[model samples]
Target: MTSALILENLCKSFGSGADAVQVLDHVALDLPQGQSLALTGDSGSGKSTLLHICAGLEPFDRGKVVLAGHDITQNDDAAGAALRRDTIGLVFQQFNLIPSLTVAANLAFQARLAGRHDPDFTTELARRLGIAQLMSRYPEQLSGGQQQRVAIGRCLAARPRLVLADEPTGNLDEATGDAVLDLMMELAAQAGTALLLVTHSTRLAQRCDSRVHLRAGKLQVPA
Candidate 1:
């Protein structure tokens, strides 16, 4: 089967010379379509860096990153941005919703940007995420969990082939987090989107189809 995301011998560094920080060192991973994998690691363990690279939000110093048959690792800014807008969805821990936009509008933002807006699908996602009632409100008016639901809805609105989530539930309470994650997983499965989620919760990691741990800037399958 073709991989939805493939990273081969990935390496990334920040800054220069003595001040440079190496976040990923020859890391490699492959995630097939419709599968979900949890990436777990301590703070600054390169988990978020890996997600950024895979999502085309950041560039890797070396190695290849292929998403849905497109080699995005070496693309120029415009090309990479286009690929990301068309093929990748990202959910961050900060719930990066536009503060001024209404919930419904925020959910539809990316889809509209990608020229793939589908009101019907956005409505369904809102309903499934239990955020239909909050659609008229702005991000500040909603609770953390509600904001997260909106974020997830926004990512799913485009029905992109790959979803990259970074600490998606880190700010929510246990019950709310579990409920939101359940909905996310269900929707991701239904959409057949490959999910790469960076998380710290072992229970959450165990619930995914596979789990990978980042240590010393390399990925290892958990035993």
Candidate 2:
């Protein structure tokens, strides 16, 4: 089967000359459709940098990023933005929901941007995330877990082929975090969306189909 996401010899750097700092050094990875992979590492180990590169949010100095059969690594900014809007979904630890938008509006935001808004799907996701009753509420009115659910729901509403999560459960209590992770995995599986999750929790990483460790800018197969 064709991979849902692939990265080949990925390399990224920041600064220049004497100040140059390499974040990714010839990193490579692939995730088949419907597969889930967890990325774990210490602070500044390139986990988030790799995630950003995969999501087309950051440019790589050298490498290829193919998502859902499109090689978007070299696409122009506009093309990359379009590709990301159409094929990629990202969830961050901060639950970056718009404060002025209601839960339902936030859930529909990405879908609207992608021009693939499906009322039925958004409604179902809201219900599944247990935010249906709070659809009219603003982000500020909800708890941290509730806001994160809305964030997840917003991503799912886009029906993205690949989902990138960065420390998605990092802000929640243990019970809430587990519950959210479970819901995310279940939903991603049901949608056949490949998931690349960067997390620090060993238990969470173990729940994925594969676990990888990143250290000193290199990735290793979990022992």
Q: Which candidate is the best by TM-score?
A: 1
What TM-score does model 2 achieve against the real structure? 0.93
Candidate 2 local Cα displacement, residue 160, angstroms: 1.0
Residue 221's C-alpha lDDT in candidate 1? 89
lDDT of 2: 0.88
| lDDT tens digits by residue: candidate 2, 81-169 | 89989989999777889999999999999999999899998998888777899999999999887888889889889988899999887
lDDT of 1 by residue, 68-158 (tens): 9998855888988889899999998878899989999999999999998999999988987788999899999998878988998899899
Stretches off by above 4 angstroms in model 2 are none
Clashing pairs in 1: none
lDDT of residue 3 for candidate 1: 90
After superposition, candidate 1 runs with Cα above 4 Å error: none
The clash numbers for all candidates, in the given order, read: 0, 0
Question: What is the total number of backbone clashes in candidate 1?
Answer: 0
TM-score of each: 0.94, 0.93
